[model samples]
Target: MAIEIKNTQENFWSSDFGKEYTDRNSRDTRDWDKFYLDTYGVTKTTINEKILGNLPKDAKILEVGCNTGMQLVGLQKMGFTNLYGVELQPYAVEQAKKYTQNINIIQGSGFELPFKDNYFDLVCTNGVLIHIAPENHHGFMSEIVRCSKKYITGFEYFIEGDVESVNYRGNEGFLWKADFCSIYKKTFPNLDVIQKDFYPYITDKNLIDCMFLLEKK
Candidate 1:
């Protein structure tokens, strides 16, 4: 039997709302490329090349909350062979398997990742952290840190100040933005920053997205 999800955010993402999100975001590789280009002023390929190009092609990498596995597919295209993903919703998991080849995409929660500690060379989340409630942020970060053997990375909505909740699709209490990199560093003293950069939204320069890589020190 699967583990029970008790958290409100987890319950929210694992329900019909999550299925709708999957349906809305599911797109071809070309569309994804265009999306990154339009939103971040760069392609996913370019972002991957910048952040991950130096790592070995066979590095063990896992993506937390990898909806539909498009990020894994992009990594595969860049010649990375060992890739894995964990997603919450079964519907998203099904979509991921159909979209990816030779990649392991499992249905699991980020809060209780079903993996051995220090198993992955790099564990990452993209646009997943912002949805976590502030009260659960520490536990969530701890799990990601526990699974990462060498590096932890995040690409998320960023605010320079304290955590700020934002309404999503007109719903409150489901989304937030903060200085996520700083949070990780403060929460886990052993982590050291490798790379950190902010990309402004194309339409609104004041709105920012961030990507950072943290190494175990």
Candidate 2:
């Protein structure tokens, strides 16, 4: 029988498996300071200079799996006023609220977003989509695109073709890699790739990811 992926994901992220992450991040052990994505080295400065330039200071942005709200905090500091985040894990949501400001943190799943259509100027995920099962990708993608008025972004592990399973802390099928760019391009014909960049993870040299920025036509 197929595993209930949502239940499995909820269990993994709400417990110590997820708490440890938020805890570590709070203590400065996780380097998610500023608009720079920790461990992976993707930064707002770098991204603005390279791919997406001239982001409005007051644009509405939402992060799909904003674990500890670090990225949201970073964006606020960078001058973005209206910011929002949705996190499935309760502990993470609590921690994010405790730490960040000017951002609405909601406890919800990506498959069924609670926001209205074209609500956010930019909608994104940082290393979050990899955890979703392939079958559920269509569901999540549709909601992400629907909520975003102009831009959709994914900074995630790159898989050229098929879904590849990742072994995480003795867990199997919890993580998978896919070419997010290809998937987005194929899914929405009106969306055009604005920028694409790749780099290796600092924590683990073997792990690599691609940052994709797509503009809705």
Candidate 3:
């Protein structure tokens, strides 16, 4: 049975718009390597090594809004055996299952993750939080914090000040950028920063993306 999506942003991602996104973003491992290299001047492997290499290969990792599971594929290639993903769109979940091996991909919502509290060693999101509306940010962050037993990590558009919405492909109120790490830190003080870096868009340096790993204290 499909869960009822209550949030407007959640509905948007579970609709045709989200399926279109899934179609456009169904990249394999090689494609992701090139994308990270081109966009961030580093490969996904290097980024994962920097942020997660220290953890054991059996570490349980969950990526919220995993799209088609390319990121989990990357982790799998790195020898991580326990990889899981939760995505809002059923199409994306199906695509992920088709492409990946030994990975658990499920259709679900980030707002109400189906996992128990502190169930995963690392909970992550990539370019996901920006799509959530500002009014629901706290609830979303709380879920991430609740599900993460040790670390919470993500990569997102970064701004120093208030939340700012950006028009995404002519759609309004569906994308936003802000200091997401600061919000997590302020909201859950038990989380301590483990690793942080900013990668600017190769074409426009003004547009920056930030990634961080935070450990629950």
Candidate 4:
């Protein structure tokens, strides 16, 4: 499916896929948090040990689509301060606020974040963009980059090739194209991709996701 471009501010807030993915993701969190915890010991410990170990502590961090604030807890455990997050789902926002007393949790769209320009030392998005409409991906990335002062980190799931497809998570969003990373690099000329590696998530044996670290030049 070719991605349709949407420009309305309301669509940004109340996206169809966002609502669907939130519903599914929240259900997964409620049902699978314990199972995941039992299998992997400590909140995001496995992922953090693998992908997030190199990030700078004490930097202002903003996590987009921070469901249940698991990432916040992980960052705090790693000695990170000045943490903030934005979650579109009301339940997720409330759950995230309950998880972290110091972190700021805002309910808004990733494309239209409620913050001043260059507000964060790092902007991070984990498993969020796969649900966004493809045509709007560039605009959404622009918004994220605009908010970041020094760096941007992302955990993204993308498929290679011209055929468009939605991911296992139920959403009409963009799948990864092999050249999408090139597109991102071109969009942010000053943001140099420092590290990126493709990793297979054990949860789904067939899928491939990558963790990326980008620093401003």
Candidate 5:
């Protein structure tokens, strides 16, 4: 049997695989415009009307593990002025800055976000929580909530029950899927699920992407 290693955000995202992830969207303007929408159907309008319509346009927002900052770019185009992001990959950070302007896209880890408690109006993680190891999920989630003042949002893969590992490129225990909304309410009892939405990709039949908007009570 092979020894299963836990890949932290700090380590795996700094590796070449992470760089390869960003290289997919870099060096092309047209490719960057509708990247999130064309790929995941997650558009600036989807985020605005569905997830964050309640909040003001000037709300301070932070995206943890904002890969290439395309999502942040989408939010920016939606009239959101206060946008911020933390990316573990250096190449992703460089690419993000080059791709979008007037946004604070810093290089950092999701394990320990470098921000004061209750700093942002909404703290978000898009497709980020699914990658964290199950055991470390609590710490990561706690840090995310710690940095947010009002809301916490997650646009992630959804499964029915507990965290289940999935193989990524023949590597096991890297990607995961679970009921994140339930987990979030369980993890933080005071937080309530304000809204939730689900979307299945047109290209893939079985996979469902879920987004949950959670509010601290």
Candidate 6:
């Protein structure tokens, strides 16, 4: 018999088994925040500076999992206004709105974003791709392509497995199977993979694996 994953008020925006796993591990969100700030948070800001350098000023950017508007601060310094964020965490969405201006922080899922097609000049996220379920990876990636008018950047775990496990300090979960780069290439054939890397921006020195920067065709 197939094990069923039911949605609930706790994990309203998640897919099958997501609610149970996410709720079963409430500290995951807190640890997730810490991991980013520790690993690749500052590096990500520097990388985006180089990648987005000399791009059109006032480029509209959308962040798929903008937790509390941290990256928006970096983009603001980069002279890219017109920022938007979609987050599953209700608290994170609310806090994000408090810090940023002209930001559209929506409480929505990445798999089904509440935005029009091709609506942004750039779409980016840090440590977001691994959280989504394997079956839903295609849809989420397609949505990013559909909404992006210029570029897409993503940072995620690069482990190879039909189903892999990710451990954040004490929090752990099964990572839905999907290749980080393949999904982008397969979904948006026109887009070019501009940058890719794996490094230790974390305390453990091996927590984060994959990072990508793609330009729209």
Candidate with top lDDT is 1
Lowest summed lDDT window (length 10), candidate 6: 1-10
Query: Over the stretch 34-140, how does candidate 2's per-residue lDDT look in tens digits?
Result: 42566656665565445445788788889998987876776676667888998887788888767787789988888778889999999999888898777777888
**Best TM-score goes to which candidate?**
1
Please say which candidate is ahead in lDDT: 1 or 3: 1
How do all models score by TM-score?
0.98, 0.86, 0.97, 0.75, 0.90, 0.74
lDDT of 5 by residue, 38-129 (tens): 65676546655788876899999999989788778778777899999998887788877677899999877777788999999999988888
Q: Give each prediction's root-mean-square deviation over alpha carbons.
A: 0.9, 4.0, 1.0, 5.3, 4.5, 6.2
Answer with 1 or 5, whichever has the higher TM-score.
1
Residue 107 CA error for candidate 3 (Å)? 0.8
Q: Residue 108 in candidate 1 has what lDDT?
A: 89
Model 2: pairs clashing at backbone N, Cα or C within 3 Å: none
Say which prediction, candidate 2 or candidate 5, comes out ahead on lDDT: 5
lDDT of each residue in 141-200, candidate 4, tens digit only: 898888989888776765666525655443333444333455578777887877776665
Lowest-scoring 10 consecutive residues by lDDT in candidate 1? 1-10
**In model 3, what lDDT does residue 212 have?**
89
Clashing pairs in 5: none
When sorted by TM-score, best at the front, the candidate numbers are 1, 3, 5, 2, 4, 6
In candidate 5, position 83 carries an lDDT of 95
**Once superposed on the true structure, which residue ranges of model 2 sit more than 4 Å away at CA?**
1-7, 27-30, 33-45
Off by over 4 Å in 1: none
Q: State which candidate, 2 or 4, has the greater TM-score.
A: 2
